[model samples]
Every structure is written in structure tokens, then in C-alpha cells.
Target: MTDKVLALVTGASRGIGRAVAERLARTGHKVIGTATSESGAAAIREALQAIDPANDGIVLNIADAAQTAEALKAFLDQHGTPEVVVNNAGITRDNLFLRMSDEEWEAVINTNLSGVFRVCKAMVKPMLKQKSGAIVNVSSIIGTTGNAGQANYAAAKAGLEGFTRSLAQEVASRNITVNCVAPGFIKTDMTDVLPEAQKEAILATVPCKRLGQAEEIAAAVAFLASSDAKYITGQTIHVNGGMNMG
Candidate 1:
């Protein structure tokens, strides 16, 4: 077996996912980043060129069970199971609970919650066989704070945390750890689209008086996947710039 650790990061076209993929690669892993579209996958591949020429991206819409299975199987057949897997692919459909359409709720839940389910299901067997792996899921503060106009997102993220805990218990005996990283407001394309006034209002609420960086979140994920975190699982590390603290 190759001594080089391998990591797979979903939704790596941009934002926090991209940062995680690059960070893992820089930390000595051969990273395979996924994007929903061919163009996005290409962009990921190009972005990682500076770190490792062998680093590449794949087109994977985690919402599609067949595609997720096929892609994962092909990777396993070729490169074996990754030592680290980050479930970072998620979407948000904002609307009041009263006005939330069935399509909107389903879309967010299916992609954010069920997609991770599919990925985990596919990875579990290999991880069990390998007897060592880390699965770090990206959750959100909205799940805990309960943001308005984001019922679907909150529900999905909360469900993800629950899922993380249960899976951690089931696989801990095999030395596989499952954990979550819940980020507060981060400056991604999703947050960048907010109006200036709205952005300022949010910053005002954060004790740090600024939005979190993608790299900061990536750092949290890297730690959780490292040996330092081998004894820690079934928990969440909130990286929200003191937006919401215990």
C-alpha cells in the first residue's frame, strides 16, 4: 500500500471545500476533489496543479446515488479507499417555513443530508476493511441557532450532526472516526451575494466582527482528521468566529 495518505473532498470547486482539498494536499495527501459539474471539476484540477501534479478532480453530484456509487467504486478499484473523506457538498434554499416549497425543502435535504448518507454508506465497508479512516462532515451554525428563512438548511445540518454521532459509534471499534465541523458565516460565493447592509448586520452579531475564512474551517477539518483527533469523535468543532459559543 502507498504510504501517502489520500483524501476525498466533496464540493471542492470553490469556497471551504476547495480550501480543504488544497490544504490536505499541502499536508502530504493525494487529494481527489469533487465538483458537481465538469467545468467545476476542471477548475479544481487546475487549482491544485501548483501543489501536486497528480492531484485531480472528479464530477460527482452526491445527490445522485448511482453516480456517487459508481464514482466511489471506480476510485476504490483504482486507488483503494481514501484515508480521509470530507462531506462538504451542500446547498441552501432560503425561504420562510410557511412559504418553503416542497421542491426547495427536498432539494436541500436530499443533497445536504441524504447525499452525505450515500457517501458514508459507500465508504463504510472499505473503511471497515482498512480499519482506519476519518470522516469529517461540514455542518452549519444555522443548524443550532435556527435561522429564519433557512428551515431546510437547518434541518439538514442538524440531521447531519446526528448522523455523524451514530456513525462514529458504529465504526469506532474499527478505528474510524466520524466528526463534524460547523462553520458560522463564511465569506464564500453564497455569503458574498448578500447585500452590503445585510453583511454588515451579520458582522455586527459576530463577536469577532468579521466573517470566518475558508482556510480557518479547513484547518479545523484537518485537525479532526489527524492523529491528534484519534481519540475524539462523535463531536462538533464550531468555527464561527465566536458567533455562537458554549
Candidate 2:
């Protein structure tokens, strides 16, 4: 049997999720990262395998309740309960509140908010039985700052933070810590496509005058998932380069 801590990271295909998965693997955890598509899963598997052969990847659509339940059950039965779970899968349907279609709002809410609920539901019982675990959900600065053209995204992330707090209270006695890492303007593909003027406008607002790196965000998550943070729970660690200091 592997001696490494077992960790599950959702949305490991790219960006923050990929960084978090790789960070956990390099830091001595046997990570199983998830992606919604087969190709994305394979990519994650390859990247994680390079770090440690015990690390793996799988296709898991957290938005689908049946699939999430079945796949998570199989993973638990086969690999035993994971010591850490990172809910990093999320989507954004950017549009002005008045212009947003019902589908756009529902899709973001279902995948971002409901999806997390499903994942936590599947893992919390196992963690309770084991009496120890860490759950770190990735949130966003938009949730707190209320960005324009991102109402759905903001609501989902805000809801996620609230959920983290409540769940942490419920499971604290069982030794499971739940927390959130709220990132601001991160240097990801999503931000890379912005025009130079837009990028400059964004950078001007951050006191650090730089876009946060995925690795930096991963570091915060890593800390929260580690035993070093055993006493910290139900807290949202803002990693936003000094934006939204509230």
C-alpha cells in the first residue's frame, strides 16, 4: 500500500486546478485529479504521473449527481477514503445581469455551486467516519467585490464560501476542516486573452501591481490542506494580490 496521503482535486485539466493537483503531488500526497473530458483526464494523469507514479487522474463530471455519486463511491471503495478534497471545478458565464439568459445563470450555478454540494456530500460522510480530513474550496474575489458582467459567477463563489463555513461547523468535532481560497485576477488563460488596456486597468487596481500566479494560489490551498493548518477552519484565505482587502 502507498504511504502517501490520498488527495482528490477536481478540475485538474488546467489553470488553478492543475497547479493545485501538481503541488499536492510534489508535496508528498498521492493525488487523484479529475477532469470532465477524457482528453483532459489523460492530460492530468500524464502530468501527475511525472510527479509520482501513484498519482492519477479520472473523468468526473461533478455537475452530474448520479455520475458523481457512483464514481466517488468506486474511488473510495478502491482507494480508500481520501485525506484531502479540493473543489476547484467551476465555470463562468459572463454577462450583464439584465442580458444574462436563464441557461447561462443556471449552468454556472449548477456546475459551480450545486456541483460542489454534490462533491462534498459524497466525501463528507467518509471523512466523518475516518474522523479526519481537509476540504478546500476555490472561491473568487469577484464573489466579494461584485464584478460587472459576472453575476452568476459571483453568486456561485459567494455561496461556496458560505457553504464552506457551515460545513466546517458541522464537521469540526469530527476533525474535518473546511475552508476557501479566494483568488483575484490570476494569470490564467482566461486573463491572458484580455486586451493590454484591460490587463493594465486590472493591474492598476491591485496593490501588488501584478496578476497572481496559479502556483501562489496553490500554495495557499496546500497550506490549508496540510496538518499545519489543523486548527484553521471555516476561513476564507484571500490570495488576490491586495485586491478586495475586506
- Per-residue C-alpha lDDT of model 1 across residues 73-132, encoded as one tens digit per residue: 887787788899999999888999999999999999999999999999988999999999
Which ranges of candidate 1 are over 4 A from the true structure?
Answer: none
RMSD of 1: 1.0
Tens digits of per-residue lDDT, candidate 2, 1-246, equal: 899999999999899999999999999899999999999999999999999988889999988889999989988998899999999999888999999999999999999999999999999998999999999999999889889999999999999999999999999999999999999999999999999999999999999999999999999999999999999999999999898887
> What is the total number of backbone clashes in candidate 2?
0
Q: Please tell me which predicted candidate would have the highest TM-score against the true structure.
A: 2
Question: What's the TM-score of each model vs. the native?
Answer: 0.98, 0.99
